[model samples]
Target: MLYYEDLTTGRRFQTASHTLSEDEIIAFASQFDPQPFHTDPQAAKTSVFDGLAASGWHTSSLTMRLITASELKDVANGLIGMGIRDMRWPRPTRAGDTLRAEVEVLGQKPSTSQPGFGVVQLRWTTLNQHDDIAMQLETSIWVARRPVTTTEPA
Candidate 1:
């Protein structure tokens, strides 16, 4: 299990690909975003995207899933997300687009007020099969520290 001490700045990780399905895209959008570009094909054709696309929130959710499923599955304490920043969807995510996630440890530091815990700043990026970035976000995570051990004097 990875702990705060186990992570290093500039370290990177990647996740498996997830192929988006048209049904899933529309279904997710209908529930959350409900925008024409995401929920209606014909309406999307007239929208700025010019075609059906997935909601930005949906893409962010998928990115989180991929990260947890692969990138941080082995961590000692999964994570407590402090907050997200600089979130952007540069390219629209469309049905049939295969997406994968990448994680980079941008910075880390021990918690000043809390013992046995630390904070890590991470940059997450989701890219398509063509290697174009679909979405990106920077977030801070609370990480646990490894337990201290002491041996009796012999």
Candidate 2:
């Protein structure tokens, strides 16, 4: 399990690909986002996207799923999301678009008020099959530090 001390600045981890199916896209949008561009294929043709596209929220949720399945699962304290910033969807995520994530550790600092805990900043970028960036965000998390161990007298 990775602890705060194990995370290095500029370290990157890649997650497995997730293929966005049309049904999945529509279903997610219908429940959470529910926009014409995301739910109704016929109506989406007249929207700015010009066709069916996944909602940004759906993309973000998928990213969370990928992170949990890939990176966060092994973390000792797991990950406590402090906040998120600079969220942007540069390109539309359309049906059949296979997506993968690259998560980079941007920085880390020990918590001033809490020992054995630290804060980490990470940049997550999701790319499509053609390598176009579909979504990007910066997030902060609180991670537990590795316990200090000392040899016992034998």
Candidate 3:
């Protein structure tokens, strides 16, 4: 299990490969994004993308899935995602493109007000099979830590 002590300024982890499928992309976009480039291939051909592509939200969600499957669950100390910063979708993620996620610990500080918890900042980068970065962001999360305990005199 991951504790606050395990988190260091340079700690990092990489996720396994995950390929995007046309059906899955369309299904996800149809319900949430519903954009022409994301849901319909023919329409996307005429659009700026020139082909079907995954929605930004869908890409983020897929990144989360890759994280979960990477066995980070044991180390995640009740992560409370504060929010994302400097988010950018640099390249279009088309169907059939395999993706992976890499997370690096940027900083961490024990919560002054809340005991047994620390705030951690991390930078996540998702890259496609061609090694091109598809999405990137920085996020903060609250992680549980081992609290100091005082022993009573025998």
lDDT of 2 at 142: 92
RMSD of 2: 0.8
Tens-place lDDT per residue, model 2, 32-128, is: 9999999999999999999999999999999888888896678788878999999999989999999999899999999999999999999999999
Tens-place lDDT per residue, model 3, 1-154, is 7777787899998999889999999999999999999999999999989999999999999998888777566764655688899999998999999999999999999989987788889898999999999999999988888656899999
The clash count of every prediction, one per candidate, is 0, 0, 0
| Per-residue lDDT value at 129 in model 1 | 96
Estimate the TM-score of every prediction.
0.97, 0.97, 0.92
What's the CA RMSD for each of the models? 0.9, 0.8, 1.8
What is the full ranking by TM-score, best candidate first? 2, 1, 3
- Give Cα-based local distance difference scores for all models: 0.93, 0.93, 0.89
lDDT of 2: 0.93
Model 1 over residues 1-154: C-alpha lDDT tens digits? Answer: 8898877899998999999999999999999999989999999999999999999999999998999899588778886899999999999999999999999999999999998999999999999999999999999999999999999999
- What candidate 3 gets wrong by more than 4 Å, as runs, is 147-154
Worst 10 residues of 1 by lDDT: 71-80
TM-score of decoy 1: 0.97
List the candidate 1 regions with Cα displacement exceeding 4 Å.
Answer: none
Residue-level lDDT for 134 in candidate 2: 94
